[model samples]
Target chain A: MVPQEHPLEQLLRSDRMPHIWCPGCGLGTDLGCYLRALSGMDLDKVAFVSGIGCSGRAAGYVAVDSFHVTHGRGIPFAIGLKVANPELTVTVWGGDGDIFAIGGNHFIHAARRNIELNVICINNAIYGMTGGQVAPSTPLRAKTTTTPYGNYEHPFNFSYMAAASGATYVARWTTAHTKELTKSMREALEWKGFSFIEVISMCPTTFGRRNGFADGLEMLKDMKARSEVKNFPDLEDTDIGEKIVVGKFVEKEKRSYLEEVKQWR
Target chain B: MSMKSWQNQRGFLFLKEERCKGCGFCIDLCPKKVLRQSEVMNAKGYHPPELYDVEGCIMCDICTEICPDFAIYRYRSKERGKNA
Candidate 1:
């Protein structure tokens, strides 16, 4: 009966068998890292919120008080829960477009206010769910459905943005770095102030086939070969071409918005 | 590599064949090269991997973690007696 059950059967929504992610997608791997971080923790104290995108489906699959919120609105919803019950570990998972494009304002304000929340952005470069449209995180000269001639606009450096917005904890990791990613997630889960993790996962279906990768494995191998770890990654060099830099860019102990508000009252 | 030897190394390594999408992440990334793509197709028309090697399999469970489809899982033998 080796095929009887999955190891994370208790952690996942087994009734919703066979997730919707395409074959060779990296979203599954990212979810696996999140699940590993959830291990040895009280599930009742967790509340997962996800915005619209391929990564958005993540909220529905986890066996927790998960919320599949509106586009780019995951942060606000998570904030509502955290404010109402500060004890819950509120997390928002979204794609590059969902987090950086539509939810950009909320993200910046939340970070600036130093909210006690964990924000995970899985940047696949383009909008994978909507046919690989050019996104704010897409690298310069990268091709997408809307930017077939290559994107001329410069891309946003997510780690740099999070740090500049006053996030206490910011880190960047690719899907290939599983152990490191899981470790980063665990740290963020335990941290007090605003924390952001940007994961460079693969989108072989739309972003890959058009960009030259034959499959997710090839993209993962390329990421493994191209990625360089740096504790102090140069923010200016994060364009996702030539080579990729991955590591913890900024981490500091700071008072969260809730703590400050309570003191002011 | 024989089945007996593979079993000796692994207390339990499960795969939900129907859930596999044949992405080959587990097989390609396996540290020990213990698995290969099975020729048969499942209900989803994807070729799930099968264990073929008996040597060098550390039973690291990397496949279980790396599998995007969540098709692979492992249980440690009672002799080793660590948590799954």
Candidate 2:
């Protein structure tokens, strides 16, 4: 007898199963949420873009018109896609290192210009793909390969940064908050202007081991315990540290870059 | 709440054992506490989650939602099965 296909099989490239993501890594959960968010939508018009990193591989796994771009270039590539065909739903998925480190300039500019694209920043706090190195989103005093002593650098509060930089939609959630993350993705997809969703993910093999978590499940439990959901909290108070503020921090109507370009045309 | 528990409820939970990485996300987040890691190891050497008690399962699908590996899923029967 033929086995039944998984409900999410259609959205995923089944041949790519046994994905490269390490066991207990939160990328799979984030990817699942994203796929679920797009499941009932017009997938034909959806485009997934990613940059070099563990999260970059997401583009290949998703059964959509996808682009696996260069390191730190996912946002620009997605922006170009949006500009070329304003009808398509363009989303840039990448790790915090790819999105906030090398491609940070593009990230800020796109948000400042209010580009019509969805940006899913999977923040595992370390450069998971290139070995566990320090990342822009790495918390203070966290141990990484580069930060053997401890990460002294202050991490970027992505939710606050996006809001301050002019993103019309800004939100943050941990992988443990599956239902909320999926719902936030759906809402971000519907939003017209630049939308940013920072999903704090687990890198069990690398970050978790280095940071003292027993495994991925322990890391998730820590996230679940530390995260406090507050809708529209003050931007200044949203900094990453001991307690992570996770929720829809900002959502407001704004004319997208494409809308302004159309007006100019 | 007690009255709702009195009705004969039926639900099904399936685990694609090979696909699971034994992350424990499902067991941790399962609202009904119906899942627990089994002693048996799969091909990957991870103890995949097993259904422990089905009595309080509301078919919430929390396990499916929290599972990173897409290894577990659940469904509820339209008609309640005969009470054991």
Candidate 3:
């Protein structure tokens, strides 16, 4: 008989098992992929940071050096950590609202500056941790706690924003695409400049009940059905929709912020 | 390949019952019909998965990758099959 321990025990704070995430939420799936991608790397060199949200709990679950920082400050804090010790492979994991709304400026600037960091944004459509408020990335006209009548604001196309902001590497995949997500995450980590990966996760407890999705598995199956893989797809055509375009939209070589800064010195 | 042939080189499944939140990802996504939700519930009153057909498991690790909770995994067994 094989040892009964979970394979990921070494990478998890096992005492904290049975996490606070809802039963059908996608955060755990995304975190599993993230951990799989980090395999074979020196654990000491990886620095994980997360902002306040349901997805932010990923940092606490991970066994690596992680920071569960203030709301919307994950990117800036990660950038500081990278600058202080460029040797450390820094990554920021946050929800869509935390990344594209409150930390919007920091995200664009970090990408524009070509910071060496991997950003994983879990896009579950609503502000789940805050009880399903209409988030900046929530689909237009979606019902939420705050948007009882429906939301009027348009959501950000995460991959397009990252590509436009000058991120050297960008990709988007749903939580169901575990293998592809893992591969993309590995590539993002390997890339020397700014990298962003948007994972469309399902928030069944808060976001799903309000939306058409009856449960998480249904949402996951729907997400899988909607996804059309198009490697190096046109950024404009990669918006989330009935038939979502999922793939790596951008990959280019660029001098990192540290590299450029060092050249001036 | 036949079922016996596949069974010869199968994986040993492991479950963390206490940690499972009964998401059903592993049971639903298992390529082989080897995992099922337990009739008995955990301390949290949720049904976790149990190995239903150990021989049918292929060690794909899809369950491990797809589980929202870190509740299930298929550990590689040392016994190698004579007929590959």
Candidate 4:
């Protein structure tokens, strides 16, 4: 009877009822969407790969076949999985530091090659797992353990980076936009080329407590209020100061990296 | 007066039908039996969950807590004087 339940729901350990995420953490919602999407898909055809970090925990929670890959190496692992079994739907999950910092080169090339894999970047704006360290996504002047005085470095616009780097499908959605995030994820799964979705979730215990967000709910509500929904080009530079712009910024079809490589073969 | 009157309060919980994948997490988790699967398919054709007894709400807020998507919200009834 339990087996008849939605595969993803059944896959989860209800006994593990209380989740590890802090209350109001968006990662749980992202996991929910991932489970829902995977429920509608063929379970036998799915494989998830993730690098080290809080975001990497997703691979463990998911019931599907998944890889807990090394730090900053999730993308390559997923690429290898897909290349070996083109029929499998592979997904890579990682934090901003692991993927965009240490694994930066692989990330760019993965996009350039257009590997047909779904990449979910959980951009919490700080290195959450090890402590609230400064990350590539930490906004200018935001405080972190490494930058207690406030970080002066400009953060990477992950969506624009992926879009410009030749990823066929690119989008950004905050944890607050659950519906849009879920929709974008579903769309990303259906895409034949490289798909990237940057999810802005909150790290309550570390980022929130340290940065005065108080709790996860406060962070989620604050982000919901501050995030502006807009087209990429229509977004004004001035608005970036008031709040972060969030939405499905890009979705286009291009020659997939897998197909391009096949051409040489 | 009728069954409708017994279910007239209409809580703040509303499912964005196009977004709900009919995973039934909401249905399985509602503490007050307020939500049920709708017979009419929504815009996305998924049988999104719906409220069964709007007037029967004790406003426990458990559904909102269990919801991973944060898709549900509990609002204060205007007649309740003190909002929850």
Q: In lDDT terms, which candidate is top?
A: 1
Expressed as tens digits, the lDDT of each residue in A139-165 for candidate 3 is 888899998999898888988999999
True contacts preserved, each candidate? 0.76, 0.50, 0.87, 0.13
Off by over 4 Å in 1: A1-4, B1-6, B78-84
* B-chain TM-score for every candidate: 0.77, 0.76, 0.75, 0.62
Residues A138-196 of candidate 2 have per-residue lDDT tens digits of: 88999999999999998888888889899999999999999999999999998899999
Which regions of candidate 4 fall more than 4 Å away from where they truly are?
A1-8, A13-17, A232-240, B1-84
Model 2, residue B54: displacement in angstroms? 4.2
| TM-score of chain B as predicted in candidate 1 | 0.77
Superposition error at B6 for model 1 (Å): 6.6
Best by DockQ: 3
Q: Write one digit per residue (lDDT tens) for candidate 1, span B1-84.
A: 011113644566667787788999999999888899999888889988888764456667798888887777776564445644
Record all residue pairs in model 2 with backbone atoms less than 3 Å apart, i.e. clashing: none
Q: Which tens-of-lDDT digit does each residue in A98-198 have in candidate 4?
A: 89989988999999888899999988888887988988888788888989898899888787788778888877778767668878888888889999988
CA-lDDT, candidates in order: 0.87, 0.86, 0.87, 0.72
DockQ, each predicted model: 0.58, 0.37, 0.67, 0.09
Q: Model 2 residue A1 lDDT?
A: 24
